[model samples]
Target: MAGPNIKHAAYHGPSIMKEIFFGISLSLMAGYLWKRHHWNIQRRTREFYGLLDRGEISVVVEDD
Candidate 1:
């Protein structure tokens, strides 16, 4: 025969699992978006600098 407290504990387990699962899901999504944005900006910067190095583009730095 099971006690009343044991039944409540059993029901709470799945609710905890659901919360953990959603938390991980949100974290992974945020990480992926951050990585993607960083990669794109780095790529563009490199390409622009590469073009400048080749004398195909001119850069003017203003004196402060």
Candidate 2:
């Protein structure tokens, strides 16, 4: 019984590695998307106002 149990013991190394890789990939993707969206909004706002630089750190969007 001891020998059989040892033989069937679970190894979680591969699953843990896979989860770490997946988490990193997802975090990087989310960060990239967030940055891209922010840049796009800044670009559009600059074009609309003919601004030369992104001087302000934040912009208020009012409902119309």
Candidate 3:
């Protein structure tokens, strides 16, 4: 019990718990957005394939 006086060391800024919560929330939101974007890409790809299969769109070859 022979430590120095440390009574005035309280941090008066954002709380650690709050910061952690916000960081976790932001990360989860980012992941959710990424998943949605991936799903969108997949859906578009499927649609494009369907169109091609049904002859709704065609591919043209060019000479080299």
Candidate 4:
């Protein structure tokens, strides 16, 4: 039931190296993006607080 001259399909080959490379690259990119976003949010929050402290903005509450 086994053939001695069977060839592997074009879509079926060794791709371990490629997979690992892409996986690492994509993860690194995602991590970079996440960190950048976190830093931006932190900076915005700090700026908002600073503005509030300097009286640049105010919080008003309305009772209904």
Candidate 5:
């Protein structure tokens, strides 16, 4: 009886340029997200502080 030989598939990893491009793109995306998050946090904090300073913290109950 003769056994069949199987050839494994070869994998070509990402090129150096591809890796660099992906790294830069991912870094930019992360930075943008981080900056946006910080901006939103700061805006909310400022709003809260402004309301507090003006003594506008009140709860009004409304029936729908």
Candidate 6:
């Protein structure tokens, strides 16, 4: 009983730690990508608005 419990604990300890590490790594990567995506969107929006402000582009509104 003692031997089996010790073996199980040893096996599960590293497994649990590996899972936690991967989870943290994935979360950090996802957060970084999300932040970059947000920045890119904001940059594009600013550029578009700047173009409109400069009369480089125009929008035509139509009546529904």
Question: Per-residue lDDT for 26 in model 4?
Answer: 100
Best-first order by TM-score = 4, 1, 3, 5, 6, 2
What are the lDDT scores of the predictions, listed in order? 0.89, 0.79, 0.94, 0.93, 0.90, 0.88
lDDT of 6 by residue, 1-64 (tens): 3454443334434577888999999999999999999999999999999999998888977589
Q: What is the lDDT of residue 62 in candidate 4?
A: 56
Candidate 2 lDDT trough over 10 residues, lowest sum: 50-59
Flag clash pairs in model 5.
none
> How well is each residue in 1-64 modelled by candidate 2, as lDDT tens digits?
3454455677656687888999999999999999999999999977866643554443566689
Best by lDDT: 3
Which structure is stronger by lDDT: 3 or 4? 3
Clash pairs (backbone) in predicted model 1? none
Model 4, 2-63: lDDT tens per residue?
A: 76988776777769999999999999999999999999999999999999999878887657
Query: Which runs of model 6 end up more than 4 angstroms from their true locations?
Result: 1-14, 61-64
Q: Sort every candidate by lDDT, greatest first.
A: 3, 4, 5, 1, 6, 2
What does candidate 1's lDDT look like per residue over 1-64, in tens digits?
Answer: 9657653334434587889999999999999999999999999999999999998888887589
Clashing pairs in 3: none
Error at 44, model 4, angstroms: 0.7
Candidate 4 regions exceeding 4 Å error are 1-12, 61-64
Which portions of model 1 show Cα errors greater than 4 Å?
Answer: 1-14, 61-64
**What's the residue-level lDDT of 28 in candidate 6?**
100
Write model 3 residue lDDT over 5-61, tens digit each, in one string: 777877799989999999999999999999999999999999999999998887866
